[model samples]
Target: MQAKSRALHEFGATFLGPALHVYAEAIESSGADHLPVCLAREGWCFHRLLKRLQRDHAIDLPRDPVYLRVSRTLLFRAMLGSETITRMALGNDFSGSVLDLMRKRFGLQLHEIFSALPIELLRFNCELPKDKDTVFEWLSPHLKALTTVVSPTRRALTAYLERSGLTDPHVRPLMLDLGYSGTIQKILTHTLKRDTSGLYFIATKPGETAVGDHQALLKGVFHEGVGWRSGCTMLDRSLLFECLLTAPHGQMVDMRQKSNGEFEYFYGREAATQRHFQDLKTVFDGAIDHVIMCRRHGVTYTRGDVQDLYEVFATKPNCIPHDVWHLFNVDDDIAGNGMINPMQMFAI
Candidate 1:
């Protein structure tokens, strides 16, 4: 267990090194005027690291990064206010029952969705087609009912954003997140009706396309291209990075404003008491220690270094104990995907 924890910590530091470098470069290129905002809960580490680095004079930023309490589920639900929903908003692919869609996408309970959805649709609560287009076609007829049920949530999200100063007229937010696609950034650009900039650890083809579509300025720190190309092997096991760089909290499921003008947050269930929770925490601590050490010694790591480390862990299953693999789990409750082991997300 000690060896496994140390390996994870070292890997975490190496992973963050290049990401931090790229973030600095992004700040330079995009101008220092934009307010840096880290998207939760993946961006939680980056936000913390940035503040730490700034204190040590390892990196400098015009303003502190804001840790925004938003999620893909909340953003997707907010898009329901629009008359037309894009493929991105609907998700690239979907696989679940209608009930799952209601609960996951709109945060509707069974009782709440039962009253809104037609009887015909309710009967097919087994599973929906995996193809997003097919799912969208099936949902086309009932969008009105779905939107009506979810509109209040959208209003709440808008209010939350406003309360957080994300919608401030004078400030432009540069979103930071560990990335595959820039879905959150794209949605924010649309919702705010303003062009936004995003700095990601990586941006897949869909993300690059969103740059043009939404007029977003997005840069992938490590590899920004279509799929896992020759040099971008890390994208193959991206979920591992997410597992390491998570916040010690449950995912934000819903938010509402009270009559007193205060906001209330609702979170999804989390496995904080899971057996592997302490191990996960230790790995995070290792990463933070690495950052401090690097700053103190003026040491820097290259992207090549990050990739090589990735290869070591990716190729050698023995590097991590067999028991530790199954113990680690990540939640994708936003999509109703449930808990998943990061190692199991890709074939190693």
Candidate 2:
């Protein structure tokens, strides 16, 4: 096991060396996001992960145009959901770049939405219910109230899905993310009204819910295959999820409808946010270059390779890098509780 572990690490050092170097450079250059350079590093990691999915998993992912279209739409929708919760939680105190972004994105005065909800149910860092039905029950009213805001975005997303071939019968729409119950996937399926599946880099367990004709499915690449697996893999590699899946922008709050009958997204941002995005872009570009080079050289990654590395980490917490310790510590309790265990970072 030790020999194989050493071999895998060496392989990573060699195959992923350039990407790692780029990550290091991005980290050294940025201090915009909380906990040093978290968001920028995440962009680097996400690019590598996406490349792996496209290559090793044979997911039929498209290049820039499709990739950007899907990523931006999905991210905007997901962040809009989060920002709604934040507004409910923070109330008047929620004023900031994030709040402003939500207002602009959704084209709604957040105060009205917050005023309509039972704000007492929300609190700082509060976890939404695990039961999808219950969450829907809670959010349904809010969703209905924001229908005008969300509907146009949903329509835009459906068109985007069609253009990306996800809505086509011959195409299987698969989305990838860091891990856990695929709430994003579920919401997307619900919105797109398509049978969309998610292939998470790492997952806790499986959660399935049927919404109309669409069903949300999730599978983990490394740890859990179908559902949550009770093991050290999820715990030891918890930090890995954090460092890889972050977005550089403030959470998107809503969508504004245009007089032209189209919807435009609103995201929270400031000068610091642009810096974070620029740093993230450097990492992404470097990773893309690394992936292209590897592909040209016939370098292939497999699920087995990922599992081997995960096994070593599962059994040895000390194997995690020292820099990840602070971020790891930030959400140790959440990991212990079996929740998503994501770091607040730029989102909060």
Candidate 3:
């Protein structure tokens, strides 16, 4: 992440020469609606995390340490949902703000906050090749393929289905399970929680007007796929990225879940109230290294650029499996989360 952030900063500074700084976001919107965890101490660890990533990646960083701290703080403020929540949780009297006017005085780098925590990213392996250009193409070619594909099945269910009792396809328990998974995800995931919706307008940039329409900047990019290519085509996903930038709005959907469960879709958003997809996208483009506590250890997570990274994180980045399962409205909970399916404890 540190290496990637530096390259982007150099590119932006040398080429575009726009501000020589990037306004980054932290735990971006989870593309879809789902209650996100609001951790008060998240920012507290961000600074240290940045250093850890730098050391791990062996990247040369600036001398002034405080900038790193501030950068992470801003990233946390932007991505974690709402500033109001962060303000309230961290305390009513918060400082360390790096907004436009304040930015000149405290120009923080984007790398600081991103490398804060370590999460163990489960090994996706051959299951899904990381392709930023066409995540949708690589993962799910057809939405229905999300269900009909092979899944981790309960051994007994398979044996039972093979027996004569399951002569009728519609009546079969496996069929019912598959049907329930899709039906429930579509219905419940769509219902909105005023707080977690992906597309929203927080506040117009004080004086910084939109480049094109001069409208309140808002939108997100979300993707859902298990493998490299599945239901949606890669071209479609890439086009979606372009669309979000040019078009008025849309949230990036990176939520990845399956009919059964091995992997999952992460439902996420800032802890702040009333933030929009655009804000999330901006913040996401900032960070350096996000920790995965477990698997995928010591491996560099090379995706797209800051913009591309935002798209990946927007839908499904290093997310907790349980979190994703609930967020995207999938029904693979072994403990019977009833939101999608009644507890199948008896069968298990």
Candidate 4:
């Protein structure tokens, strides 16, 4: 399926044309709100292609022209729509069995990360580890050279807790955030709950500044084998994602401040200035890209003592969360301003 999709997508430009646009134009010209069910289904390419192909053939004819040329007699283009073309192109395979096979065999990868394990939203709270050095020993193998691994370490700690019986009331969700299988969706369909909590997991995407600062909203969750996977190689960032599960409340946190530091790209203007001004957003249509992560800084842990969470990196992470939202002080303590700890980086 992946190979087929790659083949199809590489030639995707050829698949689309003015056919839909022309239909839309015609519909608007006729000014109809409701289109016939037959007409509405024309845009999708769910039909199967013939297994055999001629040495040479024209795939270039306009859809309307093809309908006309093939029919020999004059007929309204609208009258003969997608289904006829699909059936003809498919050599009368109207059952769509090929399409169903393709659809079931695979679909587009939706999440940035996928795991055989469920990405469960486990909730717990803890201070800095008393014997923190041994916390990440299990995950050291997956860690990149010179890269401090955080997620797996925290995960090792949690699993250790479970094994030692220190982690009471531990509810494992249907899907966890690590391992070979990459999505919660597949796991939910494939496995039954091993423990209570019904094998279901809940999630909300990482935190944001515009949201209210509530203790319940600010803590964290932990994930294993998940960080290096995200292309975030700096050690600190990975730790932040893990700390979200260990916060005081059932809140979730993520390292959002990585880009709040310096970045340079060569474009029309100084890309640094462009990015700096992106979050400020005074200019509507300037060089600022409306990327979803434009506002992301280093990850923040919610609910627990922020200082202890800051210590998890084995070095100081820049107090970026406080600095970005604070005013009147570049050196404010409450709003971790002007701090960038190298240890905080999970991956390079």
Each prediction's Cα lDDT score?
0.67, 0.43, 0.23, 0.20
Worst 10 residues of 1 by lDDT: 205-214
Kindly indicate the candidate among 1 and 4 with the higher lDDT.
1
RMSD of 1: 3.6
Pick by TM-score: 1 or 2, better one: 1
Q: 76, model 4: CA deviation in Å?
A: 47
lDDT of 3 at 147: 21
Cα error, residue 10 of model 1, in Å, equals: 5.0
Query: What's the residue-level lDDT of 128 in candidate 2?
Result: 29
The better-scoring model by TM-score among 3 and 4 is: 3
lDDT of 4 by residue, 113-189 (tens): 12211122111111113222231232133233212212332233234324323223332221122112122222221
**Weakest lDDT window of 10 consecutive positions for candidate 3:** 172-181
For model 3, the superposed segments whose C-alpha errors exceed 4 Å read 1-45, 53-57, 67-320, 323-348
- Measured on C-alpha atoms, candidate 3 has an lDDT of 0.23
- In the range 1-348, model 3's lDDT, one tens digit per residue, is 455444433332321111101211211212222221111122222333334444564333322112111111222222222222222222211223222111211121234222321112111211112221232232223223222221221122233223323223232111000010121111111111111111211111111212222222122222222222343222223321121221111111122234563222222222221133333232223323324211124433221243444334334533212211111221211111212211121111
Candidate whose lDDT is highest: 1
